[model samples]
Target: MSRSRLMSSSSLSVHGLGKRYGEFVALAPTDLEVAAGEFLTLLGPSGSGKTTLLSLIAGLAAPDDGAIRIGGADVTYRPPYERDLGMVFQNYALFPHMTIEDNIAFPLKMRKVKGADAKKRAAEALELVRLPHVAKRFPRELSGGQQQRIALARCLVYRPSIILMDEPLGALDKKLREHMQLEIKRIHRELGTTIVYVTHDQEEAMTMSDRICLMNSGKIEQLGAPGDLYFRPRTVFVADFLGESNLLPAQVDRNEAGTLAVTLDGGAGSGQAIGNGADLAAGAKVTVMVRPQNITVRPAGEGSGRLKGRLTDIMVTGSLTKLYLEALAPGLPQLVAAYPTRTLSDDHSIGDVLELDWQAQDAVAIPAGQ
Candidate 1:
């Protein structure tokens, strides 16, 4: 039991999975697959169906439709215990009455594993979490971070084919949460266990996930590597939900080359829709989504595609500075830009005319919000 007693590389797949609570659709029909050892994060705002999807995969709740497969075996109808998967709950469901070692060994004992083997495996699991000496400590006696490590180690004891985490680090403070993120990454690298992590924290998902599946309204919004989803979101919701975006409504028209031209309305220097934009019908209304970090600020008349505006506010935080400006385009949204303090444009106070512009390629155009 102290040796490699792990399950074979497993790929978890859900086909047409859906769930309901009375008349409310908790989860819409969903199809997803996790390759063996891949760290896929389910990211979305609260009530976006991420938790429902995770619970379905873990067999904590029965699915109303579709099938689930693990390690090439259909397990949709199987109970949680029979699915051979480990789940780390958000509340750190550790036994308050047990010692750390006993808590880690609980799973093995439930499975009727031999005493000697279970103890050896529990020790190995404790060591894997770098907490070998804490085995004798009671759960209530340990720090919150220590208790979390114990919960993780307990999940690791059985070496299930897949591990599902539902906001496992949500309770920890900022510093400890960051530390645990690295720890989880290290364990995943060492054990190569397939992980399906659910969290509403975008930064956390970006830090640990190999890829992210963004959910919205009980359906998958976008699924891809973090950068792909952030940089090139396919839908308006995807663009707005994944990160901060300056969504400027504009008119779109196609050129002779079948390219979309965007016309953003800013007061004096507002650009008109010409045949020079993304792919959209002529005269169609679209929204230009740009990240605050992508915007370059300058004194009016200094940059191309500049939106002349008055500096409304500025914030200087440690190595970064954020600038907020009133819109130059009569109906344009307020402009926001964030960048390194070392890269600040000339010193300009409030009432300074500022222009905000970004490379055309940096801005994504999608239909106006629904």
Candidate 2:
């Protein structure tokens, strides 16, 4: 099906939204636009105000300042019941006294839907989550994954245009959580619902979101697609938070052709700056972040030997190995690289000095204090 066919007719807009608790600011005056059917993830650590922003949108809490619009209609002062939103929580929030059918039909009841029509909607919703045969079961009789699906079905039964999910899969184990990720993607594609999801897990955000709004200290740090945020981070906080990072201080040498050249601090290495384009003057202090998987370890002097460090540790995890290398001089932070376990050289061992290399374009350089 065409994407537009699956998308809602309206978008969610937050205009200068602000919230405060006593002397502490929970959310700064901020504006954001979530396109219809877009899956946007609010990503950050606890206490970062992501939840506070979500609450304001859900009308669970009134914003101290700003207006929220659903498809261009103002809803800032509206009550939760009037906002037309579907919510899924970390806890299943299922009623133990109710059967699966009753739980799914509760929202329709509130909307005054009953009798055959309500039952039909409940059945369709149960089948939407692939639990068509579970209507006769009670919440206590279902597994965690099944109960979570029931919660999802309950949320979908009413067909709200906007869905807000606050760590809905957080209660599941890793394997099941992963499985549900694909399921959620499938559901989202089929329904064309505009989903605003919140999670602290970077991997989950990257896997499921069309765009990620990374938050820090109660503010948005960066907003972009997963690969753009991962490969071309604009700030040090963004670089370190999104994934594994090898951050090294560096000085700009010059811009060569379309690429900028830089000298690594502590004699780490010198290479062309690829995707990062923070304007910097010569000798400006900047930090370059490289992912562990990008760095290659080779026997010292075997290749370019651009930088040499002593192998200090080897951490093996099934198919991959984490190799730690530190500079010969004291005080330099160790470099961590990921290598395929099957291809690791038997000749190399801890205490063996090795040359570490990475494609210049693979590193993202950010200005100091960014």
Candidate 3:
């Protein structure tokens, strides 16, 4: 699908992209269509090919096979210079010898944009990053954030439609890294430029991107809005990697009315079939996945289904409290519960016995996938 009609000059579409180093695959077959003015993040761990994919689109590295279209023009074989896209590297890569002004003006000068216009563009670039007064200083004179801004300014000076960022904020301290995330997001909104950002930080991707493309190995694991990925992960890997989860083994024994009768074990003793109009055959095995925050803890009471457990650990993490429990029964798995700290009546200590419960709606059965 071409984004030409909907995207401005900054929109991009990629199809069947793959990269290989001899027999070793760096990236598998992939397709991604980024809307104009959208902030899409390529999120994955190291060796997941997120950087390789970004390089392929930026024309920094060629793909073994695929097609790349930017602003409706086929540029699969175009060199990086001809792609007309701005790129920011992890190291900033600012020219040490050039003044801030000259570094920002390099792209314009290379394109034969001369004299008064090039200098003016450079100055405006500096102003956009709020460092206009430092134009005369070289890269070494600026702080890490300033240098990064200058690199960003250099990339934006020529007004490229697409901007590819590879861990541009990775070098900064935590506070500064967070600050730059907002700045980058604000810049993208203001320019309405298509941005393809790469990062291994889940929080960063969730906080800054309009959508996230989660990759594993050399292929895409899942792609969706951040919220969708958070709430409805499709696989065990997706469930475990995106955030904390408690996976319980469940077996479907029967379907009555709209609910399923799932026999759950390993701290999932009170398992009940839960879903809207779900129908499944008996004797089917599925994994019941639940997030920690969804489970509630209380003292043992009269209930048809509840597990007895000893509080093995209590971790008070400011906003929330994490409770790790060891089930008394052998067939039950160890139970983990996370809830708002304020919800607990008494401060829980190690060795305290507690009851764990949850609504069926809070859990989902993940059928095996091919």
lDDT of each: 0.83, 0.86, 0.81
Ranking by TM-score: 2, 1, 3
On TM-score, the stronger of 2 and 3 is 2
Candidate 2: the clashing residue pairs are 6-192
**Model 1, residue 82: C-alpha shift (Å):** 0.6
Worst 10 residues of 1 by lDDT: 268-277
RMSD, every candidate, angstroms? 3.0, 2.1, 4.1
Across 1-370, the per-residue lDDT of candidate 3 in tens digits comes to 1233212456799899999999889999899999978899999999999999999998988888889999889999999989878889888888899988999999889999987999987887777778889999988999999899999999988888888999999999989999899888877766677899999998899999999999999999889999777766766677778878877777776766646667776544656535322345677776667788987777666344455678998887878888898877666667788977785454777898787666766776665441
Candidate 2 C-alpha lDDT tens digits along 1-370 = 3434323535999988999999999999988899988999999999888999999999999999999999889999999888889999999999899999999999899899867999988888887889999899999999999999999989988888899999999999999999899999999988889999999999999999999999988789898999999999999889989988888878888866536678877766676666366667677787878899998788988856666789888888778888888876444577888877875455679899888788878887788889
List model 1 lDDT by residue over 1-370, tens digit each.
2224643458999999999999999899999989999999999999899999998888889999999999889999999988889889779888888889999999999999999999998998988889999889888898888888899999989888899999999999999999999999988888888999999999999899999999998999889999987887777788778777787787765544543556675433433322222456767777777888988888777887446668989888768788888885578777788888875554979888877777766777776653
Worst 10 residues of 2 by lDDT: 1-10
| Candidate 1 ranges with C-alpha deviation above 4 Å | 1-7, 253-260, 266-279, 343-346
Candidate topping TM-score? 2
Stretches > 4 Å off in candidate 3: 1-8, 253-261, 272-281, 302-308, 329-334, 341-346
Q: Could you tell which candidate, 1 or 3, scores higher by TM-score?
A: 1
Question: Which sequence of candidate numbers ranks them by lDDT, best first?
Answer: 2, 1, 3
Model 1's alpha-carbon lDDT is 0.83
